[model samples]
Target: MTSRVNPQQPSGTAPVVPAHRVVVLLFEGLQLMDVTGPLDVYTAANEYGAHYVTSTVSPDGGPVTTTAGLRLVPDLSLDEVDFPVDTLVIPGRPDWWAAVADTALVAGITRLADRARTVASVCAGAFPLAATGLLDGRRAATHWRLADDLAARYPKVEVDSDAIFVRDGRFITSAGISAGIDLTLSLVESDLGPDIARKAAKFLVVFMARPGGQSQFSVRQSPRHPAHSVLRQVLDQVAADPAADHGLPALAARAGVSSRHLTRLFRTETGGTAAQYVERIRVEAAQALLEAGDDALDTVARRSGFGSEETLRRAFRRRLGVSPGIYRDRFRTTRPHGTRED
Candidate 1:
């Protein structure tokens, strides 16, 4: 009998690709969750049968202390790390400002990135990644509080303060703390397919896709005060009673100016229209109500001046990227999570 040619053993063919290599870069004073959160997501994917080879590395081939006070020994140091890593994840340090200023570490990162197929930053890790010049001219997201500073420092990088995470080219940057998981899940989806990612998300008890942009947090409490006293008065009036009418005509009349002039003033002073400001005020009111109480959706809508549930839903979708019910579910303070009174 003729010798059989093994289809699996095609001679002269290139070797098959191995399991993906994921290297998480650890540093002194790094946020513990920033390293563990994304790593857990990847490791959980492996638990579901996806093949991912994960390891940790640091500047020195030794143990490093995290912000949480736990000392972690890395698998290797930057010197021992293999070249052409499949995924290079840099977790955030508490003092990213100082991390960027560490010339030796920044040089090592640039060298590592030069060989890595994909590069990522968790939260303020973007600071060091940005320092490497890879994020230059790329759209990136950091913790919303520090986004402005990042933009100010690296004028070449476009900082998106509102995104939960951003991917530009081979660089993935995420907003503060929990957003790293979101970014990693997206990567898992891209690498292993959506089914695996969905299962992993379920296993982790996280949303397959979280409902909204980065939570507004402190930004909503302080909007810019208009230079014009009338605009300030209009803002105050709207805040005083979100249920009340504060349309352009009403505002224009109250300001003792023509509607067109009022519109121009609003654009100049607030950088948006009168209608936009009112909608934001209403959304803020709705957010406050949802967070504080267990009111009916319709009641909340009407009280927030949305007039109807559909309008409230639309407004929430437009501004928060989530439905009213979903927002309430995520933010409700009236009851402890996963507890329903019998």
Candidate 2:
């Protein structure tokens, strides 16, 4: 059998050939889901004649035990590898912050950063990347719980907690475990085109193609009581008509409560002011329209309560790291009979 060319193996090249070199990093207490999620997806790409390569690496050339007691053997030591890597990925560990404080792990990551075309992390693996100073002043994302810490520790970096994954040039970071699959499939798509990525998504039975900006947990509120169903109903109403300039006064009237009491109640229950909650709902609504691929950008923005495309773009950049147009192109669904893929 004649082997085909693997384009993704060479760093920074347009992918015409299949992926040639992909490396994954493993460390002590790594999350089993993070390591295996990308690994499984990439392995499928290889089966389809993607001509990919994968290897595990460790700082000391030994088996690294995971948080779940699964030990992974590294193919190469931190000092022994010489292959040109197109994509270098690091899996998240349970106590990633503690591990990152270790100089050896940080050095291993920094060395890999020097050679890889694209350097990426899953969840807390971002801690090491942040420590490496590769993400300074760059747009990135991580698990929501760590967002504040990542921001405070790496004061130079801008962290968006809502995104499933974020790409800052060649540096990529993903949220918790499952999002790693989303990010990896996206990488395949970016390298080979949407067709291959879609195929991989289908093969994995995962929704690799999704629209909308990353929805922030800060925007979602948990109800304090089953009796607070009234408040939930009001939220639903606001979500349905975000473009309407409904205010605390109007919302309180609808909920049959005084505006002052309603404000205090919302803050107590959701940990956010009513206005902040409304903004989150509106932004999320706008994201849905943009991802749907049915309406014009301006129309989507208007309906989603953004008022204008420019407003939507600014919010998207501030929150999602990429522009709205790019986000739509990446995650928007094309109508099978009528829309074009490219």
Candidate 3:
């Protein structure tokens, strides 16, 4: 049971009992955007007639400074939180690894998570949450820059670097920065349905389901051409058309250099073997095709220069840790978080 709030009336003017109670756990050195972005989504949802009460809580019920130098005051201390939590949000700070080492903070989070129906982390917040062992054997997401570190730190938690957000059962984790909004919108859709979610998204001037996942924003997706002129044209050709013949001999011949010289340049400049670079480029190409269209796997393979569906699968697995189909499935879930963000 919930209260219907009229937009014309002030929220405090009424004794409103929201349908959902969202508790955001604040910490020192946290990112301000990680806290505000998702909360704004919930606020926009409430404006559109949804009943969500979002509150902030800290370890000691005091003000904490963000990395950006802004100060935030929580509604109460974690110790004073007695109500049932519908969703417990964890926002990340820059020194999140250190927070994981803070036993008092980890213990507080574990305690709240135990009471919360659903748990979520924004950006690097996954680090602290994972430390609680709640994400063990669960697929999670974090900031792209911190994804490898998160995986390295918690071997039991499956880190998804590609997704803006990942939902594994009741635990939801979002990627860095603004992905928290995408995560929160997806939650809104889950609770309030697509119609109201669309209204909220429209008000915020953001897509209900954004077009693609994190691959579009990844640094690895950038073309890593060296400053040298000799390798420029060959790299350009490979990037412009992935399906073109880009064998070592062909590349060397096209660049008018010896194969040995070309290999040396690739290793020296790109820090990877020519074959490895080609495979990664091909995988990147395949990722584009998979995200953009409903092409068959074999079709995508040929277009992306993989030659066959099996080869494409192998390449995707090697590069992205998932098959081409799953990659597409994950990327396409953004029809305003239709299923992709899920």
Candidates' C-alpha lDDT: 0.79, 0.75, 0.81
Candidate 1 lDDT score at position 339: 45
Displacement of the residue 50 alpha carbon in candidate 1, Å: 2.0
Candidate closest to the true structure, highest TM-score: 2
lDDT of 1 by residue, 238-285 (tens): 878989878889878877889998888888887788898899889889
Candidate 2 C-alpha lDDT tens digits along 129-153: 8898889989888888788888988
Q: Where does candidate 1 stray beyond 4 Å?
A: 1-18, 211-219, 222-247, 250-265, 277-342
RMSD of each: 9.2, 5.8, 6.4
Q: Give the lowest summed-lDDT range of ten residues in model 3.
A: 333-342
lDDT of 1: 0.79
**Native-to-model Cα distance after best TM-score fit, residue 100 in candidate 2, in Å:** 1.2
lDDT: worst 10-residue window of model 2: 333-342
Task: List candidate 2 stretches off by more than 4 Å.
Answer: 1-18, 216-218, 222-249, 252-279, 282-342
What is the lDDT, from 0 to 100, of the residue 312 in candidate 1?
Answer: 95
Error of 1 at 130 (Å): 1.0
lDDT of 2 at 295: 79
Ranking by TM-score: 2, 1, 3
Which 10 consecutive residues of model 1 have the lowest summed lDDT? 1-10
